[model samples]
Each structure stands twice: as structure tokens, then as C-alpha cells.
Target: MEEKSWSELLAEHSPELAQISRADGEFLDADSALPAWVKQLMAMQMDAVFNHPHGARWYGRRARELGASREQVVEAIKLLRIFGGRPAMATGAEGLREPSE
Candidate 1:
């Protein structure tokens, strides 16, 4: 008889909550596997996050600081899958082709 957020629901339902690290440099999916849909959503979100003006700037800067390639930043974006807005998969897909700075 109580209201809960989507994150709470996910925490209750997803096994990843118990396994995935909440800290930096922690392995997210070491031995466990993610559901197909969750993986898809993460991919979409990551694309949306990386394609924004701020996102691109931050990513480029970080990549440069780390001596990594823009392509690596782009790939990391896809792998991380966190976006500002709930970007549609198609938009995220479009981001994949976007030229990096």
C-alpha cells in the first residue's frame, strides 16, 4: 500500500542491483548477464547521453585527457548507455555515425 519509484521497482526485480557495483571502476557485469531488454535500453540511453552538446564536449575532453581516441569515447558511450532525455533507439543509433571532435 505504498508508492515507489521505477528505480525501486528495478531494485526489487533486477538481480543486477545485488551484483552491480555502485562505485566507480567497479565491474558492472562480471559473471552475470543482463536481460536483453535492459541491455537494449542501456544502449539507447548511452547513445542519447553521448550525442548532446555537453555530452560530446565532456566526452571529448575526457578522451583527450586520457589519451584515448574519440572512437573509444563513442564506444564507451554506447557501453555505458546513460542519456539526458529518454532518447529513442533510432536517435541513439544516429549518434553512432556522428563525427567526434
Candidate 2:
């Protein structure tokens, strides 16, 4: 099996990807007062619990960029039920636990 770019996947299956991504970005970008790390980490937590592998990874990078600590990211992964998070919870926990320095 081959992997598809988001654009390719959306074109073949989820044509609404752009709109959904835009909407989600708007929601996450809403208030100026909230710290970037907070918003990214919150989104990561949702992605972790929901078992969105690509989305979780995407959130992980964003959270890292915004200064999410390893411990904080782990806490986010722990939000998932065993099955609910699936590959994402496991993968996120493993990846986020890596030493920063």
C-alpha cells in the first residue's frame, strides 16, 4: 500500500479537508491572549485522545514549536483510553518522551 499526501487523500475521499482544516485553524487561532503552547497542546490532547495519527503528529510538531515540554506532551497522550487513542496514543507517548537536549 502507498501513502497519500493530504491533498491527494482529500481529492479522492475527503474533499472537505481544506474547509475543515481552515475551520480548525480558525478555532485554534481565536484569541490572542492565550499562549501558543497552550493552544497547540490542547489541540494535541484532542488529537491524541481521538487517535488521529497524522493529526497527532502534526499537533506534536506544532506543540513542540510552541514550547510544549515532554512531560506536558505525555500528559496529553495519557488523556486517551486504551483503544480510543490507538496507534496515535502509543506513538505520541513514545515520540514525545524523547529527551529534548
Candidate 3:
């Protein structure tokens, strides 16, 4: 089988995706519930942030603290938006993680 893009997965399972992204009472256990591919994509995105300039270092340091790769953090930034951030929401639904309050 071929791998699906994050967006593809999100579109296919939008409601379930929303539930997981919302971190609602039901989303808290997402780690076990979400697909492993989504987790991997999230991790990859976190690592990619180190490539950025402005807050790259700060993000890198924070990524270390969070135990997520810089790419994963980057990915989380996107995901956070999709789950509940701002207008950027539509852009990164693939690896979206329901933001934690």
C-alpha cells in the first residue's frame, strides 16, 4: 500500500481528525488511537523547524526540552494551527494534533 499524505488522511477522516485534534475529552488518549504514520509525520515536521531562521535556535532548544525533534516541533506548529490556532488551520491538517490547553 502507498502512504497517504497528512492532508489526505485528514480529508478522509475529517470528523475523527477533528475529534483527535480538539483534545476534547475524547482526544486525550490519541497517542494510542492515532495512526503511527501521523505520529511519524508530526515528528518529521518538528525536526524541520531548525532550518528556520528567526526562532530556529529557540525552537531547537525547546524541541530538545520537549523531547521532539526540531522537525516534529515545526510539524506541531502546523498541527497546532489546524487543531485550533488561526487562519493557517487549513494548511496543515495532515499532522494536526489537538492542541493542549
Best by TM-score: 2
- Candidate 1 lDDT over 1-101, as tens digits, reads 78986557756888486345233113222223753323333433444565556534543564445455556556656555543334567666786785872
What's the true lDDT of residue 43 in model 2?
76
Segments of candidate 2 deviating more than 4 angstroms: 1-4, 7-20, 26-31, 79-101
Scanning candidate 1 in windows of ten residues, the lowest lDDT window is 23-32
Per-residue CA lDDT of model 2 for 16-57, tens digit only, reads: 886787687876755568867678877776776666877788
lDDT of 3 by residue, 12-70 (tens): 77967755655542332244666443454444444453344433444445445545565
Clashes of 3: 14
Best by lDDT: 2
The best-first sequence of candidates by TM-score reads 2, 1, 3
Better of 1 and 3 by TM-score: 1
Model 2 worst lDDT window (10 residues): 76-85
Q: Give the C-alpha lDDT of model 3.
A: 0.51
Query: Residue 53 deviation, candidate 1, in Å?
Result: 2.8
